[model samples]
Target: MGDIERALQTFHSMRVSAIMPPIFSMPIVAEDSPIVDVLKLLKTRHHVWVVNNKDEMRLEGLIRYMDVMNVLLPPEHTKARLGNISSLFKSILGGAEKASDVMERNVLVIEEDATVLDALKKMKRYKVQILAIVDENGRLVGEVSLRMLIDEFLRLMKLGGAQWTQHGSSSRSESH
Candidate 1:
């Protein structure tokens, strides 16, 4: 079969487990963690998983970078000092001052056994960059990201495109 056809077959068969990032290293924080502290943790990352507490590690929700961006500083204040950031959000956020206060409770997820097609649908429906992967028991095991999926897809396409460009036709067989 041709490279593009084979690529489609491969993509359709890809499971979440095939591309999900390892779960052990994901950044996590307590639901009650202070907003300032969470912001500090998220400064270099786009998201953080919030657990019920430091001990239990029960998944509560996710604190997206966007939430921090919305609560803490206006877009124009990207260069604002840390000291001023807290006060800026403090008044606007009212008495809810913790991660749980702003976390996205309805985090979209896909079963670990789900296919790439399943993940793409969920991502599109939720308009999220990543989809949390869960086991049958609904425990977070890992995560699948849009970047990972797209990168893999592009890698396959590039292979096909390069071959076609050099050969002036597909490197695939006649029956393809």
Candidate 2:
């Protein structure tokens, strides 16, 4: 490919390997683990992966901090009528539930070798904020979010001297 094509190609197909940290390093829990465990983990972590195998961490799905809140908090009307009392009850009761009961299944995932564009496309299609990264074995290896992707993109654009921003635009208009 030409120099321009190669440079542009980086924008379209930057591999996740360049950005993702090792996945196995993240927190994981058994699917049947009590929700209380997840809540405790989330105190210091954004989310935890749920695994099916107790002996081995085989990812089944993921439980986000927001998902736990969704379970503990009542709907808008319910909240208005029941006030904080009902939600307080749920906070105590919800802890008894298992991870599988709350974790989001069929989570969108991208292979480690896939491009950032591929990951972005899947996230958009699934309407999800985060995506699990998997290996050829389809085992959870890492996680990526739209925030990370965009930040990395912006960093690259700035480094490339593309001058696509307000300053660049003003300069272009002045030159014309």
Candidate 3:
């Protein structure tokens, strides 16, 4: 079989947890943390998860780089500009103190037990690149990113004896 097909089969057989990084590696902040902290974390990470506390670490909201950028920019630069002039002024004037003030509460999440394909589908459907991995009690566990999937695919392709040219088409070795 071709390398791409073999990679697809491997993905189907794997679960998201197999490729996700542990929660300890993920950037996390308390819901009441200062917005400045969230921005600082986002400066180094793609996204940050806001939790109720550091102990329980229940997922409360999420803050992506775009999320913080949108909040800091003028209201006209974002979609909710109709009556957000006050909001813009407030954000600029330090009215937004906590992470929850600017975080997206409707975060897209996937259970750790979900298949890699399922995670991909959810990400595609929500038009997101990252997903928070949760446990049965909705506790923050780990995270998966589009980059992770791509890395896994490339690793599998190499292991399957497939070589890609500059043009992007792959070839399989006949040394078997």
* Candidate achieving the largest TM-score: 3
Query: Could you give candidate 2's per-residue lDDT for residues 75-155 as a string of tens digits?
Result: 332242344343333343444377777777767778888898888888888798788887776677777888878777766
Candidate 1: Cα lDDT at 115: 96
Give Cα-based local distance difference scores for all models.
Answer: 0.73, 0.69, 0.82
**TM per candidate:** 0.72, 0.69, 0.84
Off by over 4 Å in 1: 53-57, 73-93, 155-176
Local distance difference test, candidate 3: 0.82
Better of 1 and 3 by TM-score: 3
Error of 2 at 149 (Å): 0.6
Model 3 quality (TM-score): 0.84
Which is the winner by TM-score between candidate 1 and candidate 2?
1
Model number with the top lDDT: 3
lDDT of 1 by residue, 61-172 (tens): 8877776655754434444476644334432244457888767777887888999988988888878888788777666777888888988876776756524546544564
Q: Sort by lDDT, best first.
A: 3, 1, 2
Ranking by TM-score: 3, 1, 2
Output the lDDT of residue 59, model 1: 70
Over 19-109, each residue of candidate 3 has an lDDT whose tens digit, in order, gives 9886778899999998888888888887889999999989998888766666687655545568654345325344677888777788999
